[model samples]
Target: MKASLLKEEFKTNKYDEMLKDLYEDASLVDYQKDRYANALDKFIELYGDENVSIYSAAGRSEISGNHTDHQHGCVLAGSINLDAIGVVARQDDVINVVSDSFNIAPIHLNDLDKKDEEEGTSEGLIRGVVSKLKELGYNIGGFKAFITSDVLVGAGLSSSAAFETIIGTIIDGLYNDMSIDMVTIAKVGQYAENVYFGKPCGLMDQCACAVGGLISIDFKDTEHPVVNHVDVDFSKYDHSLCIVDTKGSHADLTDAYGAIPAEMKDVAHYFGKEFLREVDEKEFFDHLADVRDAVKNDREILRAIHFFKENARVPQIVEALNNDDFDLFKKLIKESGNSSYKFLQNVYADFDYKHQAVSAGLALSEIVLGDHGVSRVHGGGFAGTIQAFVENDFVPEYKKEIEKLFGEGSCHVLKVRKLGGCKVVEE
Candidate 1:
């Protein structure tokens, strides 16, 4: 499920295309064949080049479901053309990470097995991946990686997951026999983000970003995620999806986001379970009174309800998509967005006032198109963009409403990309 409708054009293996872009872009300015070539050159200048190879991956978009992966629910997602490319030159038993995306110091694996609970950012993320790989008995050695990316931050896309997966893939390509699977890659990436990055995040971002394409990831069991690829072809219908950029400011989402999954877990724990999915309708209703009594916040209760309901909606949407019932699917998205606003507590986060983006986008959209326009919160739903199914005739009207709020380039009209995920080219 690429964000771009031009699936035929996007190279199946994003790394290969990114590599070419890196070479061509850097070469236009006299750049090396690989962006990290300079870093490898520096490493050799310091020590010596032994056995080194390069590998990479790209970011992904949540095509259908939102926040469902954490609850062991369903999510329709896939990789995007934009990615981070890393060229690693393996060396001694040292694991060094050189990143162009993050302008920080090069990371060296001295005590690679240790976790730094203090400064939780790039280094911890890198070390986190390395630590997980080492724990998994993966052969990890010294390598210099240069990274570059097109994935934008704060856009509701999983950029961190993309970087981590690329790092893991680079490591796998360098040492392992190229027998790495997407699930393993996803876990290793999640390990880095959760333990290393210090973000109490869920598996959705890592899975979506790692697996790529339109996949239904079932996390009913946290230890194993069952990923089912779904075919999403909406071209037969004349409708299009335009994510409205409600030109609203966003908050620092770190701590605020940390609260979401934590709180959900709390609600589930009230029913004696790991996630809302584990608690059956009977168990939830049976313990509803206890849950309400135990939790003081009303929004918490509402969010709990939203999680359960949204979880159930994933499969329905998948069925609707298969039947080409865009109308039904469109209606479901609106329902999900409304629930997120009313229950999930993400509709309007207090941090930096991010909720206004979704709210304003919906307001403006409704003003222009009476009933044909369906707009709701997209992605994490606190801000950024809202998914809107607009009438083709109302394109100009939709653009006007969107531009007035988010400026000229705020709203994006996108079609579904079909080519799932794969390595584009070796050369």
Candidate 2:
């Protein structure tokens, strides 16, 4: 379809069903209609009124597991309504992206080699995705895209994963007949981030963003993670999902983030294993003293303990959700938060103890929520956002009080979006 025709299609009722399915909030249908039409106009202005495709990839929320996925542990996560959307037109040999948030220079498909200078840049991610696709014997192509994202950056919503998912999704939809499965899309994203973008990240973020819905990912088998869609509705229990941004930059926090997996892996190395998942929980607990002496770091032992407990806790969470046990689910969420704070020790960076936005947010959330809700440090902590499951009745006050401290518009109440990365207007 031409860009102009797609804009017209969005204005009509043709795409309403698809929009509702993607966003999961009927209230946002009109908003999405306008968003798509405006993005189409931008695409027309920049790349002419050519035939184009629309795609959206969701941002994920860490529901049950924290800092456990790096050890190939189990995790419960959900894809939220917030996402990165793109309007793209297939070109010949080069790829160009103009994002509302930043600039990405053109990347030639011929030069997909990892560039040291491109590390940590968008160019690296783009080139890396294409290179991995070709290496895996998947079809590849070039496209110019105008992308926009609502996923909050530095707030632990997996914005970077969403961006990567969308790029791979565009290529999958445009050239490969959308044959790439969500898991492969996620792996491609993680590969780009790890090998090309220079981030030693686990597959949980990308997997959650690409697979969509409330999902439980068991990475014990890293190559073939077991993914199951958890069927439960938060509204049925009179609770709403809330994420409060405490306001801080994740820049320069790479070392803090990397140390987590490195330390956990160190503990695994003590037991002659590559990942913690390969070690038996009983063996780890029984050999605690010897492992502590070998690793020489009590915090790493504590983190290893957290990983085992949290990894076990993920299944209990899935069961609670499946059984509609909201109270038990909330209790497990609270326990997970306490474990992350006490054992995982990621709530605040030790070096910058003075700047403790995440800790502050968690504390304030406890005061406000008190028994009616649950709060925890969200994603690669030590900065950025906190996750809270607030009673629907208390959501307004919770958002208000949190924003008063963190500044207005800092708190976002979101719904779990059903779809992950896919072509938006397939009709």
Screening candidate 1 with a backbone cut-off below 3 angstroms (N, C-alpha, C), the clashing residue pairs are 1-213, 1-214, 13-423, 13-424, 26-31, 52-90, 78-213, 79-213, 94-142
Q: Write the per-residue lDDT of candidate 2 for residues 311-406, one digit (tens) a residue.
A: 999999999989999999999999999999999999988988889999999989999888779999998888899999999899999998999899
Q: Estimate every model's Cα lDDT from 0 to 1.
A: 0.66, 0.91
Candidate 1 residue lDDT tens string, 168-194: 776676677556787788898888877
TM-scores for all candidates: the values are 0.78, 0.95
Top candidate when judged by TM-score against the true structure: 2
Misplaced by over 4 Å in model 1 are 1-56, 87-92, 95-98, 115-118, 233-255, 286-294, 350-355, 367-373, 389-400, 413-422
Each prediction's RMSD over C-alphas, in Å, is: 6.8, 1.7
Candidate 1 Cα lDDT to native: 0.66
